[model samples]
Target: MTDMIDLSVATRRMDRVLDGIGDEHLLAATPCTEATVGMLVDHVLGLTLAFTAAASKDFEGLTDTPPTLPTGELPGGWNDVATARLSALADAWRDPDAWAGTTRAGGIDLPGEIAGLVALDELVVHGWDLAVATRQPYACEPDEIAACLAFAGTVSDEQRTEGALFGPAVSVPGDAPALHRLLGLTGRDPSWAPPG
Candidate 1:
């Protein structure tokens, strides 16, 4: 149940960040890259939902299935998707271990331990993304950052080459707070903003 607890706390933190933002700013694009505030939030929420879905269901073709963004009728937008995803995550958390089964990544079959680790990493990094999108300062708790750093260190060289998901290769200072410096290395400027 530790994994469930971790995910719950992480999701709550993100929820707090998102809930703090006014609707006007949810559409703002940060200075980072192509993703607007909505897209980035979608990316994070989408990933979380995928993980939760994997845990919940055993569809053999899931990886091949492209995810559709959640939306509503009549000019629906990011908020709709975010709200739906968050609700899904909450539902998933309620019975996390029920889906605590094997998963695959990079063609490597993963047991519950590896899958939980992956989920943990998601909670940490996406927490940072949420902060950047909302322009809210988040100081990663020491234990959580240390745990993520440990996982980051173990990421295979092949995985690192896949993309910016593991973020920049440079090492974050052991002393630096996990959330800020780690997000910085991952190309997310927590302070980033668009032109007014």
Candidate 2:
């Protein structure tokens, strides 16, 4: 499938996960990291903005660099962040030529397909992150998982070993599917325990 489709589907799934979150728990943290639910949500939104900025070749208004983890709280609630991110993505996607255009950020140069696919990976992994961080079940379709797996494969083993590109690796069940295996390879427990 094209990166655009992956990006669209991933964003929809992200919206579903964000919509399902309870307001009270939005700021709660998980055992895996100190990132509160709100922070995780914002981290995902931050990622969207960063990618959109790169795709559109606009780096003027971004407040900060997209960190691998949440450095602080989300400016508004998850709803606000979600809305902004969705709007930005919708706007960027509208100008396919622009989105498909090239640009640079922090000295890194990338094409549209690379940006979109990277965004897709983030959407999927961070969807898992939000779910895992919030003690919710992430019902990712098998195909989405497959897409993530394929993308993850592109990250050279050298990159994985460099540390933090994908979190610590977890063990996948021998009988699990490719997506589950891939998730395990990237540090998420497929059968992660819910928060107490």
Candidate 3:
């Protein structure tokens, strides 16, 4: 069996990114072509809740529904809500049981271990997206990046279709940093920035 990963690093990085967002940055373009800063934050908020539920083996409601790009204004106090949920997500996964059972997230039933890796990938990648959109510095630990890279590498070509969770892998130098490689595998340009 694979060792369980610690989620604190990814969660803390996401929290710091959340702290840097301001009202003026809400409409800024993100590396994710389909979402602006506000929409992505909304998605983060939803995913935090869904994945936390998945960690607890609670498969109803949030876990059953796949996330969509939020089109409306963020909820009041969304920052606090997101931060709290992120912490909860990390905490929920610390239980050994979470990594041992079948769990569902984003409406797909998957192994608990795979679901945990998916949650980490979301936090690490979306943390970068939010940081870049808000013009904040982003740093991910090597272990977190490696874990996400491993998960991203498992995405099949068929899963890269339109509207899929990941897109076609972008080309990056073989010697590129692990974070860059991870981003490339997830179909993101590592050097992407908000439009001027």
Candidate 4:
């Protein structure tokens, strides 16, 4: 069994990023090529709900379907809704049992431990995506970044292609910071910025 990771820090960081996003940034491009800023927020909301269900071993609608590109519209009071869901997601995974069984997320059945890591990775990476797209500062703790790095490092070319979990891994220097390496492994350039 893997060490249980506390998701509060990542969730709180994402909440801060969400707070900084304004209406003007909605149509802006994000690091995720398939999503605009608004779409990415929608995706986050969906994934937050889906992965929370996964933590509870609830294999229902959200867990059964793979996520598609989101429409670029946010629900009324989406920030409050998203924050609540993110909090629930963190709280769900704090239970040791949540990491002890098989769970389904994005229509793929995998071990609970792996699913937790995936959830963490989503929060960390997408948090960065939203931050950069909105011109906000982003910071994640070293331990959280390390955990995500370990998970991202394990993804192979075949898994990446088949699962569509990431783009082709970008090459970063061996001596780069852990976050940069994790970003590279997840197919993002550390220096990526919105188009001028």
The number of clashing residue pairs in each candidate reads 0, 0, 0, 0
lDDT values of the candidates?
0.57, 0.66, 0.88, 0.90
Q: Which 10-residue window in model 1 sums to the lowest lDDT?
A: 66-75
Write one digit per residue (lDDT tens) for candidate 4, span 20-114: 98889999998888789999999899999999999999986889998887897899999999899999999999999989879999999999999
Candidates' TM-scores? 0.69, 0.78, 0.96, 0.97
Clashing pairs in 1: none
Model 2: lDDT to the true structure = 0.66
Candidate 1 per-residue lDDT over residues 70-182, each given as its tens digit: 22121255455666676666566566563366664323456544555566676677666656666677655676666666656676656553234564455455565566565
* Candidates ranked by lDDT: 4, 3, 2, 1
* lDDT score for residue 48 of model 2: 73
**Distance (Å) between predicted and true CA of 178, model 3?**
0.7
For residue 156, model 4's alpha carbon misses the true position, in angstroms, by 0.7
Pairwise lDDT winner, candidates 2 and 4:
4
Better of 1 and 2 by TM-score: 2
* 10 residues in a row with least lDDT, candidate 3: 158-167
lDDT of 2 by residue, 27-55 (tens): 67642455677777767777777767776
Q: List the residue pairs that clash in candidate 3.
A: none
What's every prediction's RMSD, in angstroms? 4.4, 3.3, 1.1, 1.3
Once superposed on the true structure, which residue ranges of model 2 sit more than 4 Å away at CA?
1-3, 31-34, 61-69, 98-101, 105-107, 161-163
